[model samples]
Target chain A: MLRVVKPRNARSKRALDAREPKEIEDARIAIFVKGTHTGEVVNNVMKDLMALKRPDAISFSKKNVIHPFDESSPTSGSSSIQSLEFWSAKNDASLFAIGQSTKKRPNGLTFVRMYDGKVLDMVEVGIENFVSMNDIKSAKSTPGHKPLMHFASELFDTHPRFIQLKSMLMSFFNGEEVESICLAGIEHVISVSCAPTPVTLNTASTSADTATSLPKVYIRAYTTKLLSSGTRIPRVELVNMGPSIDLVLRRHRDPDSEMLKQAMRRPKLKKTDVEKGLGKKRKNFEVDEMGDLRGRVHVGKQDLDKLQTRKMKGLKGGAFDGETEEERPTKRIKTS
Target chain B: MDVSSILASHNAKYQLVTVEKETPIEVDAGFLTVTDANSIDEDTFNSNIEEHLQSLARDGVQTLLAKLFSLPTLPSSDGPLAQLPPPTTQLPRSKPLPKIKPLTKWEQFAKAKGIQKKRKDKKVWDEEGQEWVNRWGKDGKNKQVEVQWATEIKLHAAEDHDPRKAARDARKARVVKNEKQRFANTAWAQRAVEAREQRKTEIQRTLAQSRLSTASMGNFDKKLEGEKKLRGIKRKFEPTERSVEQEAKASLALLSRMESDSKKMRKNPTSEKSVLNVRKAVRFASKGEGGVALGRKTAGEKSKKGGKK
Candidate 1:
C-alpha cells in the first residue's frame, strides 16, 4: 500500500506532480537492493548493471535480510514486501533488482517490478559467466544515452518466459520516452540472444521441469561505429564493449491477469488526440503515411443550374451570333 | 618429400595451438577470465614492449576462449552455444552512497516520543455497503457525510441551514489547514539551508559596499587569484550614427513627451504660487512709510541735501 503524500509548498507540489500518473510517463526509476549474503560474483554483476542503469538508478548500500519468495507461507514474505513497497513509495521507483547468493541458489539476482507500490512480478536469474567492462579495453557509451536493444531469437516473441524477460529488459534499459531519436545519440547496442531450446522442452505444453530446462540467455554489449555511407543513413558496425554476461533462468512469478490488466490500463484519449485521428477511427478519413489528414467526401447529386462557372467573353450571352439574350439556351456549359 | 618431413616443416612454420607456460594458466570459468601467473621473460620483453604485451593479452584471451568452449554446448541456429559458469570476480561500486535526508519536525517529534509509524490501508471496510471502499479518492468514505441523503437537524437550526454545505466547508478548511502545516514542516526542514544562503548574500552585499568605499573605488586594488570581477548595471544608449530623418523623428517624440510632462506639472498653479506677499512684507518692515521715504531714511539725508543744494 502507498502512503498518501500531501504536498506542503509549490516546490514540493511540483515534485509530487512529476511522480503522478501522466498521459506520457517520465523515465522509470529503478532501485537496486542487496540481499544479506550476496557473494562476490553477485556484487560485481550488480555493480556492472548499476553502471549501465546510471542517472535513473538508486543503489541501496545496506543489506536487507528478507526473503521475497518464502514458499512456506505467502504471508511470511509480507514484511519484506512491505519494506520494498515502502522504498518504492519513498523514492518513487517502480523497478528493483535484488542480488542474493546462497548454497541452494548461488549468484542469484532477482528483478522485482512494481505497479502502484505493489509487487507485480519477480524473475530470478543465476549469473553464469560475467566479463566486466574494466576487462575489455574499448570505448563506452555516454552514461545517460539510451542503448538500442537487439533481441536475436524467435523465443523472445513465442515463449512466455522469454517474452516477460524481453519486456522486463526493455523497460529496465529504457531511458526517457522521446518522440524522435537522433542517429548520433545511438552510441551502443545491447544484444540478447538465447541458446536453442532443448528438444524435450520445445512442445507447446509447459511444465515445472521445462523451467529448469530453458536455454541460457547471453547478453553482449557493443559500441556502435557510424561510418560515412555517402547518404543520410550511416553504415553502422558493432565493436565489443565488455560486461558480457550469460544468465540461467531460475524462479519466476507471473503477474495475475486482472492485476496485469489494471497495470497496463492507459488514460482516456484527450480531445486533441481525437482531433489528430489518433483515437477511434472515423469512416472515410485516414491519416496517411506522411501524417497528412485525408478524407473521402461523398457529395449528393449537384444541380448544374446552381453551379457557378467562370464567365468568359466568348462563352457568355448566346451560343450563336444571332441569338437573343432572353431566347438563348439556359443550359450550363460543363468544363472539363 | 616424405610425409613425416612435410609434417615437421608445417608444425615449425605455424605457432603452437596450445600456450606453453612454466605455471599453468588459472582459468575462472565463472568470470570468463584467465590469469597467467608465469613471470615475464626479460629477454623477449626487452626486445619489444608492444609485442610482449600483445602476446600476453592474446594468451589470456586464448585461454578464456578455450575454457568457454569446454562448457556444455547447446545446439543453436548460429552455432553451438556454451552456457558460462557463475562469475567469481569481485568489482567495486561505481558511485558513492546516497546521503540521508534531513528529518522533518513531525518525524523528529515522533522519534523523541518513541512513536512507531503504523501503516494504514488505502481501502476501508464499509459497514452499510458491506464492501471495501477507498479511504479518500473518488466516491470515498470521507465524502459519505455530505453525499448521504438522510440528515439530522437541531431544534434551534434555521430553515435554510444546509448540513451538506457545512460539512463540505469544514472538509475544505481542514484540507487548507493540513496544507499550511505541510508548508510549515517544509520551511522548518529548510531553515538551515535558507539561513546559510541569507548569510552568503549579506556578506556579498557588505563586500560590494566596502569595495566601492575605497578612494579609487577598488579599481587599483590587487586582485586575488580566481576572484570574480564585479559587474554593475549596464546602460544602453542610442547609436551615434543614424539617418537625419530618424534622428529628427526621435527628437520630435522626445519633445512631445517633455511637453506632456510639463503640462501635467503645471496642472497645480495655486500650489506653485508663493504664499509670501513681498509688497505687504515691505510695508510692515518700513512702518507704512512708502518705498521712497523708507529708502531715504535707510540711505541717510545725504542724497536729499545734495538735491536741495
Candidate 2:
C-alpha cells in the first residue's frame, strides 16, 4: 500500500527540501493490488509516481530535516524507516520516489518465489500478516505456496532481469525450498552463458503472446558430500541475460548530502518543472545487498502525472553512474 | 583444507534426517558442546572424553578416589572399593582384637564417641572388686570403660606410651579436622537424612493435588479442541486453526464432531438446513450454535428443560 502525503501547500509551489514546511498538504494515496505482481499495475503506479516529480533546491544544513519524525502520523515509522538523520529518506527527496513516508509506517508487500514444477511462480504475504511492532525486523524465510506466486508475477512486471533469473531459479527449486535459491547455495554454477539487456515489457490482460512471456529455465541440483561443504550446484541452461540483473546489490560512493545541499543551493525549481540531475553514488554495496537505489532518480509522483505518457524520463536498462541513455520508455504493449 | 575428514563427519545419531554428502558437518564433540538434538534423544550421545572416562572405570582405574553417596557394606574391598583405607587410625593401636562383650551404657556411650579406653591401671588391692585400666596404646586390654567404676580404679601408663589416652586428650582439645577426615565424620549423616525426608514430603503433596484436580483435568480433556477454540474468543483473536475450523465446521456442532468432520456434513444436506434455520430463527444464537436445538435455549428455558433431561 503506497500513500503520498500532500504538501499542504498543495496549490502553491515551494521548495520541498527547504526548511521543513509547516504542514504537508495534498497527500495522494495509490493502492497497488497491494503486493500484486501485475507489471501493468507497477507500470501504472510507476507512471503515477513519475508525475509527482518537482525539482526543488535544498541548502546543505546540519538542521535540514530530510526526514524528521512527526508524532501526528498514526503509522509513524513503526513499520518503516525512522530516524532524524539526513540520509533517512532516499537520495531523491525532491527527485522521484516510489512513495516512502518518513512519518508513516510503510505498508510493504513481501514477495516469495518457489518452484511449482519447473516453472518459477511467486506468492505475496502482506506486511500485516507478519508479527512486527517495530520499524526494523529480521526474518528467515522458507517459501510456501502463496508467497511464491506473488513473487513470480511481480518479478515479471517490475524487473526484466528477473525473467531469466526466475527461470534459472525455478529449475533449481522444482521441488525444493526457495530460501535456498540464494547464491550461497549454488556452490558450483559457472558463469551465466550470455548477458541480456534489461527489457521492460508492459502487457495488457488476456493477450496470448504476452501470456507465454515467462518461459521456464532448466536446472538440476546434485550433491557430492564426499567432496565437502554440502554444496549443490544446479546446471542451468543459460541464455543472453542482462548486465547482472542484480544491480540492487551494487555499491558506489555518492555524496547524497552534497547533492541535496547543492540542489538546495540553487533557487528552488518551480513545482511545475524538474530537471534531471545525476544522483550521488553509494559508498559500498555487497553483491547480495538489495540493490543501490540511489540512482533511482524517479520524477516525483505529482509531476509525472502532468507529463505525456511514455515521455516520463529516466528508468531504463543501464548501470548506475553510466552516462549514456538508451532512453526507450519502458517497453509497453497493449491489448484490446 | 582437509576435505576428506570434514566430508566424512556425519551426525550418525540423526540417521532419520539423511545428511547430504557434501554438507560440512562439524565433528567437534569431545568434552563440550552437544547440539545435535537426536544425540540426546537416543542416549548414544557420548563425547570422546566421556567415553574414555567410562573405559577408565571399566578397566579398574584405582588410586583414583571416586566419591559415591553410599557404598555396599561388605568386609571385602574389590576394584574401586579396594582403594578405601581402614576406618580407625587415631584409636587404640591394638595388635590383638578385643573380645566381644555385652556393652554397658557408659562403655557404649564412650565407644559411640569413637574413643577407646586406656589399657594398664590394675588395682593394687587384691580381689576386693577394684577396677583396672591399661594405658593407651597397648590394645586397650583389660580396660572396662565406665565412669562409675572409675571411683574404684587405680591408673598407670602402660607399655606403648598410652597413645589412645593421648589421642583422647588431643580430641578433647578443639582440634580441627582436615578435609578428608572431616568428610568421613558422622556429621554428614544429618544432611543425608533431611534430604531424604524433604523428597518424601514433596511426593505426598503432589499425589494429593493430583487427586483433587482430577475433575478439572477431565473437563479440560473432554472439551479438548473446543476449549482451545473458545479461549480468547472474547478478544476477537484469530485461533491458529481458524481456517481449518471454518472449513470443517460448516454445519456441525463442535461438541461431538471431530475436527475433520467436513466430509460427513458434506455427505448430508439436512444438517445445513437445520443450522441455517437455527441461525435465522433463534435469539440465543450462542446456545443454538452449540447444537442443543432448544429454541435457542434462553437461560430460564435451559434451567427448566435441563432439570427434566
Docking quality category of candidate 1 according to DockQ thresholds: incorrect
Best by TM-score: 1
Model 1, residue B102: C-alpha shift (Å): 36
Q: Write model 2 residue lDDT over A1-336, tens digit each, in one string.
A: 223355677342344433232121111111112221223323333332222111221222122122111223443434222321112132222111121212233332221111101101222111221211121132212222111110112332234344334332222222121111222221111111111211323343323223224322111111111122222211122111111111121111122343323322322333222222213323442222343233334454587535544422453433531343233223222321
Off by over 4 Å in 2: A1-189, A193-211, A214-336, B1-250, B257-309
Candidate 1, residues B1-309: lDDT per residue as tens digits? 569997776564333334566777666554333445554455665686434444554454444444554566666665565564433432111111223357877789999999999999999999999999999878988898899998898989998999999889999999999999888877876896789899999999999888888899999998889988897889999898999999999999988987785657567566666799878887987899877778878777777788899
Best by lDDT: 1
- Stretches of candidate 1 off by over 4 Å are A1-5, A71-78, A270-282, A286-336, B1-309
lDDT of 1 by residue, A206-301 (tens): 764555788787777777665544332334556777678889988898877776777665556665565576656789976677766678999999
Reference A-B contact fraction recovered by candidate 2? 0.00
Q: Across residues B1-309, which tens digit of lDDT does each residue of candidate 2 receive? A: 777665455433223123322322211111000011111111221244223322222111110111110222233333222122211111111011222334544566898997789774443332334544343324332232322233322357555554445546655453454444455443555565678799998987675555447667534544435333322226575465667668577546554466556647565545544435645555355544654545345666878888999
